[model samples]
Target: MFKTDHRLMGEKEANNSRKNVQMQEINKRPRINLPALRDFLSQFPGKFQRHLKSRFKRPTETEGANRDIFKLKDANFSLEKQMQAWKKNPVWDDDQPPSIEVVVPEGSLCQVNVKTKVGLPPDAVYNIVTDPDNRRVFKNIKEVLSRKVLLDEGSRQIVELEQAAIWRFLWWSGTISVHVLVDQNREDYSMKFKQVKAGFMKRFEGSWRVEPILLDEKLCHPFKPKTLSEYMSCTQCNGRIASKVTLQQLVEPAIVPPPPISWYLRGITARTVEVLINDLVEEAARIKGVSATDLVTTNLNLDQALSNEIQTLDIKERWALRRRNSRVKERKDRF
Candidate 1:
C-alpha cells in the first residue's frame, strides 16, 4: 500500500513538472502584432458609396459629356447645366432623320448610337422616357411585367424591371421578356440600363442622355455660357430650349445567327430605337400644345392601374431562416 501511494505521488509530481514546462515554453514564444486598418466604409460613408457607384458607369465610347453626370445634389441640382453632357452631341438638323449607327465593339455584339435633336425641352422629353407607365406609347413594348425601385434618391433612382416586348420576323411574331436594371437620374437627365441576367441577350446595356440645345447657338458673346443655363440665352428664341438626345445601346445575343438573320436583327434594333425617339417627339409636341390643366388630367390612353402595379418575390430569408411562409401578400397570377 505504501509503495503504491509513493508511486502515485511521483506520477502527480511528473505531471505537474510537464505542465509547468509547457507553460514556460508558451510564455517564451513571440506574439504577432498586426497594424490596425481604418474602415473607410464606416468612417467615410459618403466617399465610400461614391467610390462604389463610380465603378458602375464607365465612360461612353465617344468623348461626350462631363461623365460627372452622377454628381447629384438634393437642393441645388440644376437641370439648366446638366454638367455639359450635350456639348459634343452631333449637330442634328430638324429635317434630317435621327443619326443611327451600329458598331460591333466585340465578338457578335452590336452597339447602336442614336442621336436626334428634339424641338421640345430636355425635361419634357426626359419625363416621357423615364416614366415606366409610358410603355403604352412605345409601339414595340407590350407591357412591363414587373417593376421594382431598388434605390430611390430624390433626383436619381435604381430600378429593376421585366418588360415584354413584341417582336416580329417574316410571318412569325412573338413576345420576348427582358429583365434589366435601370439607373435613372433626373439631375443629369440621363438613364443607364444593363441586363441583370442573360437570356435572349447575352449582354445588354445602354444609356440615354438628354441635354439642352439652344435654338440659336450664335447668340452668345463667348463660348462660355453667360447665364446659369448651358445653352446660351437668345433674344430671337425667348429662352426656347430644345433637347439634344442621345441613346447608346449595346446588345449581344446568346447565340448569333447567320447573315440574313443577323441583318434582320439589326433592322429590328434600329426600328425599335426609331419608335422610342418618335414616341418622345410626339409626346413632347402633344404636351407643349395642351394647357397645364389638360396635361395633368389627361388619361393618355393608358391604364390607370399600371402606375401602381408591382409584383416581386420575397426575400429568401422568409423561408430559409425561419422555415415559415412569407407574410407578404401575393397575387393569384404569381402561381
Candidate 2:
C-alpha cells in the first residue's frame, strides 16, 4: 500500500510540472489583437492613394493660364526673321545692363525672368545651351549623370537628362537629383525644359530665348551723332553678332517654408539667375576666342563679386572637389 501511494504522489507532481511548462509556453507566445490589426491594414491603401494624389496632382487652372501667355503659334517664321536680323546687324544699348526680375504671382508659384546680352552669335549661344553634354558649364550643376535622346528629327529633338545640382541657402546646403525632359527646337533657337522628378522641387519648367538684335538705320534718329556713328560703323555689322538672351522659369518647392524663409529663398533664386547669365556670357566669349582674363574683366565685375560670395558660402568647394575626385577616379579606372 505504501509503495502505491508514493507512486501516485510522483505521478501528481509530474503532471503539475507539465501543466506549469505548458502555461509558461503560452505566456511566451505574443497575443495579437487581430481585429485592430485588420482595421489598420484595411485603412492603409486609401491613405496611400490620397497621399500620392496630393503630391502628383496636375497643374492648376491658374498655372495653365499663366503658361499660355508664353506659347508660340508660328515659331519657325518668327524665329527665322529674328535670326536673319541678328546676322545682318547688331543693336544694343550701352546703358541697358543684364537684369533679373522675380514675380510671385500665386501661392508658392514663382516666376523669374532674366535678360542678358552676350557677344557671341545667337546660333553659337543656342548650340551651347541645347547640348545636353555641355551642362558642366553651369555653376550650380555638379554633374550630368545621364542623357538619353528620346526623339530626334531634323531641327527638333527631345532628350531626357539626369543631373545633380548643389543648392545652398545660407547655412543650409545639399545636393539635389533632377530628372528633366528637354524639348529643343534648333530652328527657333529655343529650348524648353520641365522636371519630371526632382528631390527638392515640386514643379520646375523653363524656356530659353536667343534673340539677335538688328536695328534698322531709320529707327536711330534720336541718338547722339557719335552714338549713331558707333552703332552704324560697329564691327558687328556683318555676322559679328551680339545676342540678347531671355530666360523665363517657373518653380515651386516641394515644401514651402515660412514667410521669412520664402523671402530668403527668393533672394537666392535671383542670385542664381545672375550667376547663370554671367556663365552664359562667359561661354559666349570663350566661343569667340576671348581669353579667360578678358572674359573675367569685361563688364563681368558683378559676376566676379558673385563668384566671391559663392565661394564664401562654402557650396562651390564641395562640388568642385567632388568633380575633381570623380575625374581622377575615372582616369585611374581607364588605366
Candidate 3:
C-alpha cells in the first residue's frame, strides 16, 4: 500500500522544475490577508488535521539540508565534560533494560493499548486500513471476511472486523481476524486483531495501545519535531511492539470505493489464505485417495468466500420471511 516512486534523472529534473515554476506563479499572485487562518485551522478537527499532517510528511531539499546545521550544534553539545557528567548519573547503572521488547507465537491472541503524541488518530487509521484502494498495504494477508460496525444504534461509535484466510500448502493455510473500533470521543480509540487459525491451526491475538503525545513548542514545527507516546500493554499475556511514523504529506489522493461484490471476486489476505485451500485439498485427497498434488492445480478455487461475506442475518428476519411462505413453516425453534 505504501511505496516510493523513483523517477529517472530526466523525469526528476523536469518535475522539480515544474514545481518551482508553479510555486513562483503562486507567489506572484496577490496574497489575501488572512490572519484568522491560523485560528480557523486550530478549530479544525478530524480530517482537517489529517490533511495538515499529510502535508507535513513531505520533505523539501531545503529541509533535508538543515540536518547539517543540527550536526554542528550537536557536535558542541557532546562535550567531554558533558559526557563525563552524564556517565556519573546513578540511574544509568540501574538494572532495568534500555528498551522493552516482546514476541508472541504466530497463532495466539493478545491485546495491548498505547498512547501517541501526535499523528493519525483512530478514524484516520481505520479509514486507511479499510479503504480498498489501500488494500495493497496488506497484500498477502487473508481476505477481509467481514467489517460490520458493532454498534449501530446511537452508539456514536463502530467496531469493524474482517476475517481472512490464505493458501500455503495442500493441507494447511492461515487465517486472521482483525477488529478496529473508532469512538467519537478523542480519548477512546483502538485497533486489535489476532491470527485466529493457521495451516497448523495455531491461534494468536494481539492489541495495540494508542495515546496522543504533546510536542514541545520549540520542537513542534516543520523544521524539528518530537513525539513521546507511551506504547505499552494495557492488557495482554505478553509484551508489545510498535511502529511510529510521522505522516508529513499525502503522496496521492484517497482511494475511491470499489464496485459492489468486488471483494467476492478476490479473496482477501494472500499470506494466510493457505488454510482455506488446504481444507479443500484435504477433502480432495480423501475423495481421490491420492496426494492433493494429483488434483489439477488450475481447477483449485483459491477465490472463495470471505469470512465476512457469509450470511449472518438475524433469526427474526429469517422467521418473518419464512412466515410468508406456505411450504416452509415458521417455527419457534432457534439455532
CA-only RMSD, every prediction: 19.2, 23.1, 25.8
Candidate 3's TM-score reads 0.26
* Candidate 1 lDDT for residue 14: 100
Query: lDDT tens string, model 2, 74-130?
Result: 334243443444444333333465888999967664789998777654667887788
Clashing pairs in 2: none
TM-score of each: 0.57, 0.55, 0.26
lDDT score of residue 4 within candidate 2: 65
Show model 2 residue runs off by greater than 4 Å: 1-95, 215-239, 292-335
Find the 10 residues in a row with the least total lDDT in model 3. Answer: 245-254
lDDT (tens digit, per residue) of candidate 1 on 114-184: 99877665676787788889886777788999999999988899999899988765557899998999999
True-structure lDDT of candidate 2 = 0.66
Candidate models: Cα lDDT each: 0.64, 0.66, 0.34
Residue 329 shift from truth in candidate 1, angstroms: 67
Residue 179 alpha-carbon offset, candidate 3, angstroms: 9.1
Arranged by lDDT with the best first, the candidates are: 2, 1, 3
> Quick one: best lDDT, which candidate?
2
TM-score of 1: 0.57
After superposition, the stretches of candidate 1 with alpha carbons farther than 4 Å from their true spots are 1-93, 217-224, 229-237, 290-335
Evaluated against the true structure, the overall lDDT of model 1 is: 0.64
